[model samples]
Target: MKRRLLTLVVALTVAGYPSAAVAGDPLSRMTLAEKVGQMVVSYVYGESATSVSAADAAANEAMFGAGVTTGAQAVEKYHLGGVIYFTWSRNLTNPPQIAALSNGLQRAAMADTGIPLQISTDQEGGTVNRIGAPLAISPGAMAIGATFDPRTAYDAAKVSGTELRALGITVTHAPVVDVNTNPRNAADGVRAFSDRTAHVATFGVAAERGYRAAGVGTTAKHFPGLGDTTVNTDNGVAVTDETREQILRTHVPPFRAIIAAGAGSIMAAHIVAPSLDPTGVPASLSRPIITGLLREKLGFDGVVVTDALEAAALGDYTDEQVIVGAVRAGVDQLLMPRSVPGAIRILLDAVASGRLSERRIDQSVRRILRTKTGSPYVVEPPVVGTPAAVDTMNRIAARSITTLRSAALPLQDGQDVLVTGWGAGTTTNLATALGATRLYTGSPSDTVIAQAVAAAAEHDVTVVTTSNAWADPTQVELVQALLATGRPIVVVAVGTPYDLASFPAAPTFVAAYGYQPPTIAALAAVLQGRAQAPGRLPVTIDGLYPYGFRAP
Candidate 1:
């Protein structure tokens, strides 16, 4: 039986399909470089399926390295374990294009390391929706949470994951389980499911279950929770000053729940919590947090991925320090290093210099390969767009449109309406639904503001849209200008639900929770009384609405 399994591994390797079948103690056969490569999942440049041209290979040279384009050469060169896709990275173009890229990259990975590439994207629905239009966009975590139904979260993930699987994307860094406790949290906003801890746990577990059902890998992210932070880790250092009590109550429960749900992966946040680990290291590099609290205490035996190795949260440290630190901290995969080749070199050197033991590397590789083989990284001929996903988005959006103050709702038929707000498609979409005479497209200028006020006077009803009015505050001028018209004003929060407190005078306030097409259309339907407002507040609006408050 042992000899037969060995023959199968050899056959699979020759066929460019090294898989869990090869997991029969394959670590003993792996070179140090192959093991190191298996731990780094980096992004490559260009929009093409293969970096065919010298120019294509050189496209991301300045950023990644010379003669090291993974989209072409580096996947084989470094034996990369996986790849991450992003719209800005040109990895995402259209449906077929992305699917082709997924297939092409996977082939390269198999040819190099004989291991399937765990291609991933941060497709956590809502404002974080990566592949827009032509693809099915699902409601985000917060919107699903507002329904007060775990099934909505499950349905959204399943639908989105199905589309994602069709794109040949095997893993999704989704179901942001971060409990958005701070209403003014700069990092999370509607990305998190709710400010409530238990609700976040419930919704997160549901989404993970949905992903499992869809046969796609699920990663519950920012493990120590970034819900209360004032800064984004992607930009700079973020500290979550949650006390021991707060950590046990607000932050840890969601992770505990998702781990129990058998999450495929958990991403460590680049947040420093003095209480969680007195060592004062970021969660991603803190052994107390990742290895101790998460792995030992919570009993999460899955892969542990770092939040972006290139993130500014760890900018203060050198590249070598960060990589070595992450490995020591028990991170399974180092995501988006500033330079993939640099990270590969760093890890190889760390092991050689006795800074990191090979046993640690082996542990991560076993988990990663297990996940890829177990969830099994479904790489089918991607369907791109599906009717099922579209239907899911529409239903979730319709269900999540919450009306806080409905005094000015069910606008008089054909009443002159002026629609203006703070997002691109949000206000225009609302205007089209209401059939407004004038559409002010969220361009907050003195001239635009004046024109909006004038138009508000001409129209019987003014529907104003806001995109995180709590932070930007630019929408305040526009809302205040429209308010002076002495007309019935309806504020539609197309981004975050906290905008209502910013404009208290508005007679009608609706929370669409996002600017997705389905969400905007749902906002229009609710305001027109064509559909009923059914969503409850998932987060507390200080001094006004409490969590779970809907129209009485």
Candidate 2:
């Protein structure tokens, strides 16, 4: 009779929660454990978690920090509403595998919790593309900006969403809407799609459309813009000097457009936009930026997420301080905080003590709930990564490879290439792609120069690639030394094209913009004359290359 009662209890529990749609309605019926779970945003390693049987309850304990299991455990166990996919683990090599793993994890998480997981990934492409899967192609925001068409931005989103959803990610933290007007910004760099306000607006709108079409919800990021700021939010103080007019006119357009297009979320930047809030509180924890401006003026009603609280950008503040401040600032999600269990206690205590209002928690929870089952995310995952689609992604990326300024490429056969750069990854990859049996001497030492001269004696072309001054001066000097050698040198600036301006003598230079493997391969192909130099410069190179210069 006792056994019968236990079996009946299990059956009643299953019957009580039929689906996610109805599960949310009884949110008030949940226990204390479930309510605390909803406040968490944590990180996990897919490969390491793969070793533990996902079916085991112990797997949840092992994968998550103390007390949490799967992200769904936050939902089922804690009544959590969301989880942001952090990519600190370097092994996620391609989109297909990442998609499959993420898809499986989210599916299992939702099944465990009886609530849909707000699964997200950082698919910004270029320097920030996290999923190596074929579905989520790595096309940076810059490429979309260069296209200057909402359709291009939309198509990239659609493709990205198709891949993300297949892997079971319903949310994508992307379309970095920061207007990068500051030439010296250390963080945004190429992460921004454009500096032009209207152009950015167009791209953001299209991106929202594409993600929606692909059945994935979009999040417009780095609110209040990090583009013109001179500070790095992760480890340094940051402030944007844009006037109120400039802020509203230039930086806010993209956010407004994407929001209007029904983007489900907006990620507040860690940088300080003092015009919006002069206390120097970073936008991520500012009431004016989050509630006053984003919610009131621009009329954004979706979830407001903070950039990773783990970023050194917030400085001196304790984790508890940051979490409480973000919630108070009207942020709906606290992204990737260092401690989930600790944060939950902090938020709950704050609410119990009246430091945070219960009404406020309800507001954020409603937005999060609306987003997970949002209209844009009506479907689970969209079909993406067809052979043709993959081909299209590659082609778009190849076409977006800005050359800055260069003489004809693919050095005539037998050209002696002089290559110098930090990190073995960039230099060796370029050599293999160009197929040049060239001499590689990394240092400017007397012995190294002597060897390089000897190697180049038999070759007609020299190819040199290096990080711009943004890295080290030695790299620039090395390129100058090669130029002094009077070899037919071709210089490629992997970081920023501006580094070449300091060059003693500008040889035929090509700006590949970034050092991703595919970008390097495409660049080498252009140098070997195997591929056409079809991409034009997306930004100015000052003295070395003009802003709009391109070579055929």
Candidate 3:
């Protein structure tokens, strides 16, 4: 049967149908159950989960059942179209383990349907990286935007894609193209490239091209744009109040560019945009937005994936509602539905009842199968922790470090310098790189604040690192206390650029845009005058520094 199906697919491809659509030709060959299964992408634990603690093991069993412990088990039970990997859930340790896991999933999938599985991860770089440790971490989207060079975007994504492909991941949920115009947007921050539509479009296309060059599928995500929202949909509903014209002008351009560049998938945002859909439904469940706007208006025939169905924004809806609503909304894949079995049952029941037509289900299944067959996962030799990849990542980070205020640059060697902040590892690494005489690590506690202040008083210069200080009042208070010491301080906003607005009185400020080791080393080099800071602010922090601001 498998040979016969392969022969049919080859014939269709030779007949000149697009290779993607040819593999799933006639769609009538699949049973209703198998077709329904193609619309679902389930999550499974990696091999590393075998070493998890008793409590975590029990929790995983409770959530996914004892039978669904491994990717093969999940594929066997759910007949899923793809697998979504989470480092925390899977406890993934290294590259070899990830490759083994991918191969296992693919073998299981091939046995079931003779089709490859779409193995995917959120390798967005910086803080959101899941394929952790030893992989060369890039400086993320905003850092690439800070350089204002599309080539930097291409190189960063190509390296990232190469590493991901080598590990057997076929799809990367990355290159967030949202124009993060609102400085107060907590959800987007450094994840977005820039506030300018043109910048987002230009760099977004480049990143997409890089991913394609490396033989991995790229997802231009959180569409129509989550850049204007202050609330993260993972926790609660976020409403975008931009007028329709404003959205068309600002938020929609980058997605258009990415689609034009042939992005394989698009992840719809969970935020509500009343301007796009008058019903005020979150874009993930709105047919007007996904089908009418994205499909009809934008002419995107690629897969439309919803953000995780379990997000708090969809809390009011039941698992059945979300599964059915997303499909009815014209989504091709339902990501991380609360229960795989429950979702499958709901979809089957929806078709059985008059709630959903079988034709709609088949349409989605064909699109998914086409994507899977056309983009077969070809495993590359593992390249994690390779020297050449690391070098490229470090060079990109060095170029992305933006020195906003540099009155204290060229710190004298052997100077009495105190380094302190959140992300203790980054602080320690930067301190060691800069030859700081002392290091104090602390969160925003009263005791830590007191210790930091005393240490600041004793040192010739103080270097304070902040990761989202504006959001954490404790960090804000700690920085304020350090500033009150009347000691010369160079503040390093390592996570988000907006931290500078909270500490405007600091003598000098630098925006690293991330906490990766390479970015930290770049920050250290800039302080020691070993490297020049060339990055420009990607977004305005209002009352602090405007976009494109950099020290002379």
Candidate 4:
């Protein structure tokens, strides 16, 4: 009940709130389609929220289903309880468009099912951030964690939540509490706040409070933990071998803190922890983990959502397998099922065949209803990219620059510096900040490496930038080639902080955690001796550095 109101999205509440599902138990009135719909969220394929334009309609038919034209049509056809926004789906283009879309989706849901759709998206900032520019662009969890300031975490989420809510989105899947133990992990990277469970809990709780204050719902995600896995469920089966005891250290603390802090939702991860469930299904659908650990052990009495159901992590588990597994595991909301109508059918079939009881369905639906009807998430319109917000974002970035070698910074004023890296224009930003020539290249190639090496030889200092180089080895090869130039070298990881592990042989190393404009500017200012590299490592680099390592 505490999770239902002011916790965060029991959300996607629009301006001038809807009357549907406002006061009574709406389950008795809902048909089977509507009941199942409450357990699932559908993805719309268009830009407009209400009207399905010709392009929007065609795309919907091609992607989601046929004859589903608008948000209203989607709710009417599938009886949806939630809608998720993704930039890849073109559902989020700009602020005004998103606001209109949110209002439109709520209006359609109210008109059709007397409910409000919890409009959701991944706004974790840094790399997982879906919408960019014009919005308050802040760094990711790791970047904020680097500051070791609870207020920074709180302010960053508030800035993001304030803007997202103004655009009509009620739910943001963020504050990844996964205690990143593996530096090679692609899924958590900077998205995770810290490797230490206590730090993760501190930042996660602060962020949740910030979102609640902003009238948006927050999700403590990738549950039980995905910190040990190198790949995401989108790529392959990301299994964690951490025993139940091990989990209590790396995974359980942040979740425990958030639940106590009044989290509205917990998004189960697709990765599997065999100690929690020997069945090998993802944690998203694991009864031992979700119901046994999160619900019973952690004492979380709130809405539970599964990571995307169509993820490759589920590994051959069809919609039926996953839907039944998740529902049985106690997941309250299912996201991005390949087919919304088909997913609804699965729920109905499960209920009819006794694989899942109607009572179970009613329980999840009641939670959704309580969240939607409890309160209207109302907030004043936020100014996109305000100075104070920008200053806060920049401050976090400035504080998060972890420099490895002190002498390598403050590049001598007259020294010729050649800046080059593998990310598009990221190196250019670094180059511009340092007033150095930039030889920008896309993913590395033999020819590009040769060219970069030759150009580095001509400069007094060679600066190289890397983005998740731990995942892609080509950047490492390029960095190695640049080091061969025998010039003073400064290697800056503009993305994942783990990139330092890939090029440890470099003369100087710095981890920026993110490559956004603010981060790049901060790194440049730090290098120019205009500011201090005050950041400490949020995650350890195995044998190389300990957590909280800062340059002398």
Candidate 5:
């Protein structure tokens, strides 16, 4: 049996295929350099030296040395264990093309490494998608929560993961599980599942389950919670005032539930939890947060990853310091560390100098190996993508749009829908797609707002799309315009849902807790009465909608 298994492994390797055991074997044999390489996930860019013509061999060598490659040689030379597959920034929207490029890179990496590397991405479906333009889903997370059914959440994730896995991606950094409690949140706005922990927990866990069931590992991210911070960790602002009680009650539950559900990983947020750790270091590098809080206290056994160390989330730490601090903080992976070799050497040096223990290094590596061990084998007839994948996404999204009216959402061909909001474009797209005579009060004046408003005043039915755009003044202006149209307004919030507080007198309101494409379609479908809206409010709309309010 042993010999037969060995023969199978050899055969699989020769045929250029990946399996769970083969993927597991390399983890045990990895040297410190190799193990460290596995821990480092970095972005690749092409470079050339000495004016080497684009086709010149020396120029090619320079580019390869610069950590960029088209095929196998990169993995062999760099000894890379995983890659965050991204297109060259210039070409972001073309999914099929990106998918093709990623598939080729994965194949080359496997050919070079003799192991299937962990390919990852941030395909969070809304505005955060790496794919742009006509393919851009929605602008944020609140949109999806508006859809309300766990099954719809699952379907959305399944579709997203299917598209990613077809391109050879093994993991996704998504389902932005953060609760959007802070209306003035500097960054998390529409990206959070909701303001209430329970609802956010529900949406997050369901999304993770769906992704994993579809063969992609799910990462419940910004651990210890990111909803309370008023600063963007990406740009050097760091904060933490969530009491240990609040963290445990609200923020930590989703991470715990998802981890319990066999989530492959969790990304640590850059914000500091000051009550837990007085040092003010971000959770990504705090032993109390990562080790004591997550590992020991909450008992999350899955991989604990750091949010991008290159982000100014670290309080003025140098590149080397950031790497060392993150590893020491109990994070299993240092995501997108800016200096790969230098960071590796710093970690090795720290371990050598007794600043970082060998035991500590082993712990992180073991968790990483465990995470990899769980990965599904990537097979190749070479996964081909079709428009059907997008169709699935749209269908699932259509199901998530929630309808809260006592009466059915009445939509007729000629009804003038007074759609206005920060995410007017999204609702406008959905309204247009639904074959409605819609009106917009915003830009691209060629589009008819006056005609639509006049039509709304004449017709009793209107649907308004409005949202608090990170406290921007525009959302308020749009809502005021729609209200003045004096139609029976069916206001659809395609954002943080806070703008409803500003227009409390409006009737027939709907909140699609995010601005992603699925939410747009979901909202449109619900408004058209083609789908049932099952979601309850995941957050309090303070001064407007009460928490847990749902219109049957």
Candidate 6:
């Protein structure tokens, strides 16, 4: 068997196909089964038996049996081309453990087909980060935008890429280039850079360059844009009303700029743009958008990856249909497919039956192999979470704090200050860091509101943290009730700038963009006058503030 495999490898190399394996060209030697296997990216729980959820642990055991644990078994069985890691997928306790997991997965792939696997994760910073604690926290994209410095955006990506590279992760699904024109957009709140095309293009390209400099491949995501939709495609379908001209002008520029900067991949959004595709197909499965627009018009030759196949935006499409449609639409890789084994079988059957052409399969497989081959692979683990990483995060956070309204910094030494709001952990952190006199943890309830009001009466000033107050009526009412107290209050919008629109009467309002520890600490620094809040608004909120607004 070894001799036959070697002969096939030699023949493929002679045929001019570049093999990703160190020994020889695996693709040239692969059977249709092996080739189809390379197109599907799957997931596995990397948490230990004791760490994973009860249901997940049981399901994993059922699938792989008693001794077979981790994603290694699945990689060997399917000869997978890539594996995407979530927070639960690995022991993120330290850098060494993550390296071990990545090395183990690659070993499994090499043993099966002499091919290395593309290890990927969503390291978009802020709330979307998959690698938990100890990794340097960033203030996310919007905060970077608020600073109005492309260098800060570049440095943030560079630091994140360095950390991810140390963890043996090769691809970061990041630098969301969506120009956030809609303040109410749920899925892309602070993930986007700005509502202005120039800012998005400028900062987004800088971020891509940073990732490339660190030897990490970057993905410019949600092609055709998800910025105008109020719905979260993860839970339901989202439709965009922008005309083709509008999309080309606002949403498409950032993607075009990043692609021109040599982004390795682009993730197609699941949202439907009826104006762009009159057929109403989701961008993930639309041939015109993926092939006609992105490939032919924009001339992007990089790999096209579909967003999570399980997203509700697909809307009742069978797993078979989703898999086949995406492939037909020019997607090179199917991310987080519902069933890996089922998808492989369907693709194999499609190829055999002429439903999907072998040439088409070859097109995507080649792109996948090319990306994996060029990825930065570390043989020896490197040190991560260094002091320098923390310092960079601190500098970014300090610069990103935007004070849109204020009546002389409310936080002062030895003053009676109360910190309260929805995200209990963030509120507590801010309160601790600022040395507030009291901390009030409450939900958006009348009882909670009344308690907050009572607590405010005793404090010299109240600092309230809000998360999406514009969308939640309860939060709106809570702020209204607090405003009625006649106590001097400072409102901190931790998630989105739109929250300020709901409480226009707020005496002082600051947009932190996200609640990452660095961001919270920065907010504390600004309030205490230890640091300057120079960040400007990245989006316009009606009845509140316009883009580029910053307090004097």
TM-score of each: 0.94, 0.84, 0.93, 0.94, 0.81, 0.93
lDDT of 4 by residue, 1-552 (tens): 001211122344335563334655567677777888888887886677657568778877765577776765786567788888988677888776777677666666656666667888999988888888888788988988998888988988998998887777888998788898877787888888888889999999999999888888888888988888888888888988777789887788999999999998999999878888897878888888889999998898799999887788876877788889899999999988877877888899988999999999988888777666433233334357778878888888888888876647778889999898867778877888889999986678889989989898888888888888877778889998887777788888877667877777777888888888888899899887889899998888876888888888
lDDT of 6 by residue, 111-198 (tens): 6776767788998988798885688887789999998999998998998898888777888998899888888898898999999999
Candidate 5 deviant stretches above 4 angstroms: 1-20, 23-29, 45-74, 87-100, 107-113, 131-148, 373-395, 403-412, 416-424, 434-464, 485-490, 515-518, 528-534
TM-score of 1: 0.94
Instruction: Tell me the tens digit of each residue's lDDT in model 2 across 1-552.
Output: 001100011122221232234332545644444444655666654442244244433545654555554443443444445655655542254444454445444444445444456667787777777766545465677664554445767777787777777655777888788887865668776777766677677777877888889788777888888888777777776778788789988888888888777878898988777778988888888998898999999899988989888888876788778999998888988887766666787888888898988777777766776665521122223355687667656666676666544553557765545454454777777777776554555534666656655565556777766654544556666666667777677777665556667783664777666667557766777777677666655555554554445764
Candidate 2 regions exceeding 4 Å error are 1-36, 46-76, 86-113, 133-136, 148-150, 374-385, 408-410, 416-420, 438-458, 543-547
**Candidate 3 pairs with clashing backbones:** none
Q: Rate the local accuracy (lDDT) of all candidates.
A: 0.81, 0.66, 0.81, 0.81, 0.65, 0.81
What C-alpha lDDT does candidate 3 achieve relative to the native structure? 0.81
Residues 281-326, model 1: lDDT tens digits? 8999999999999999999989999999888899899998789888
Task: Write down the worst ten-residue block by lDDT for model 5.
Answer: 1-10
How many clashing pairs per prediction, in order? 1, 32, 0, 2, 15, 0
Model 4: residues with Cα > 4 Å off, grouped in runs: 1-21, 373-382
What is the Cα-based lDDT of residue 404 in candidate 4? 72
The TM-score, computed over Cα atoms with residue i paired to residue i, of candidate 3 is 0.93
Candidate 3 residues 245-336, lDDT tens each? Answer: 99999999999999999888999989999988998789999999999999999999989999988899999987877888888999989998
